[model samples]
Target: MKPRSLVSQSPTSLKLTTGCEALDACLRGGFPCNSLTEIVAESGCGKTQLCLQLSLRAQLPISNGGLNGSSLYLHSELPFPFRRLHQLSKSFHLSNPNIYADHNDNPCDHVFVQNVHSVDHLLDVMPKIDSFVKSSRTRLPLKLIVLDSVAALFRSEFENTPGDLRKRSSLFFKVSGKLKRLADRFGLVVVITNQVTDFVESSDGLSGLRIGNLRGLYSSGRRVVPALGLAWANCVNSRVFISRSGDGICEERREDDESGSSSVGRRDRRRFDIVFSPYLPASSCEFVITREGICGVG
Candidate 1:
């Protein structure tokens, strides 16, 4: 008789928190554990806020769709705004006093943060991040690892010439593959933020500009091309886009004819749209960001 096979069944389910019930439903519970997910968008589009919220949500218990683990937040361009993070944490009711008590302890002991500006620096720091995760005393599974804007590395490290583009593209692919492997080995959710470039076409029939040359050129297009182009989207399991929309102005009007003397001012509320997803239907939902956190709006 042939020897019995040793392989066992894979886990049938994985749970995660989308930071909002509606989003969780859309995601069919949450993002897959031990996988990579890309969240790409332009500035002021709630990308960082979503990441911060997810980091807090990861601390919740497994039954609540969280990983019951810690998080690692890597910053590429801007340092983390502690004040904003604190405010958001308060809004979400996720503040932990104990984690703040020990000021001298390594930040990786629970929630870790690292600042890396260049691709070379990020490559150098990867081993250190692995070491920190391995040395945690609590043995709390690291549920989330976030790279706040991965495109910054490429933009800063590589030139725009064809040779440099090819070289950088290959490097990014290799690095992304390594990250995927790391997530699988550690059973952690890896979230990467990416910046986008505009796909412009001039009237003369030119094949779009290679690079824009103007003030605020980087913010012209939605941050999807860099995040989702060149097989990058295929490497990750899911993608999300967040954007804001409003009337951009406020006006005053009388609420009722009876109250002739009083005028009411109406400020348009912000809107949240889910532009794309792999596991959920393509639909948009309205939400408001308030002191109570992200709440569904009619």
Candidate 2:
């Protein structure tokens, strides 16, 4: 019998492009497979937008920086934004026509959207995902699994009591372990979104800042920390942050300036930061959300 080679057994080397050149470069190719990546940010900071773009891009061929597979999006927030996804798919398919020439087919159809109600609901659903991935019903191989927002699942379910906190932490490990296992076993890229909470300073005025990294997290002119606290933070393999500044100038600065732009109105300037990652150094880049999709701004 032939022996298995190291390269053939290792799945961690694979990656899925984020569909943006600048953001891809910052992430050292893109979100790595065989790992659990947490995208953290405040509301309306383009977290879901990025995840939606990734779901579409994951369907492209590997040569084009895609996994040539399907994605499972488990949303715990608002109803799955099918309308927004339709818009993104139209632009994505148009941009990559060589591979999508017969683009009459809808890409959104390939993305499976599931609504998760709460922590208990998610736990019940977690074990079934393994079977879903192996089933022959799916048209394409599953390469990515996205949980729209992990924070929402556990947000109001737990109290400040020690027993409740410990239980919540245990659940965090269970969910993360299953996600990481799926990623490792199937070479799937798991990306989970996390909401943020206000960062209140302690008596010494510095304890809160030490949560994830030395710099700390701030967004929209206010200091905030990723929800679910430190116990949950330690579960994921990587953490990425997206922040929005409300006073940002429009993407077309020259046009806005020339139009004497009070009528132009300001847009939020969003930034993506690699808070911590085993394969990447801490870094960030500015990005914008447009009709096409989310893209890095140089």
* Best-matching candidate per TM-score: 2
TM-score of model 2 (CA atoms): 0.89
The C-alpha stretches of model 1 lying farther than 4 A from their native spots are: 1-12, 91-109, 202-228, 250-278
lDDT digits (tens) for residues 131-178 of candidate 1 = 766876654667788889887777776677889877877777777877
Instruction: List TM-scores for all candidates, in order.
Output: 0.75, 0.89
CA lDDT of every candidate = 0.63, 0.84
Q: Give the TM-score of candidate 1.
A: 0.75
Q: For residues 1-298, write the lDDT of model 2, one tens digit per residue.
A: 9975887655557789988888998898998888899999998888899999999999989988999889999999977898999999888877776654565556776798899989888888877888888883766798999999999999888998999999999999999988888898888999999999998877977547565443777786788888998888899999999987655454447556777653323354588888888888878888888788877775
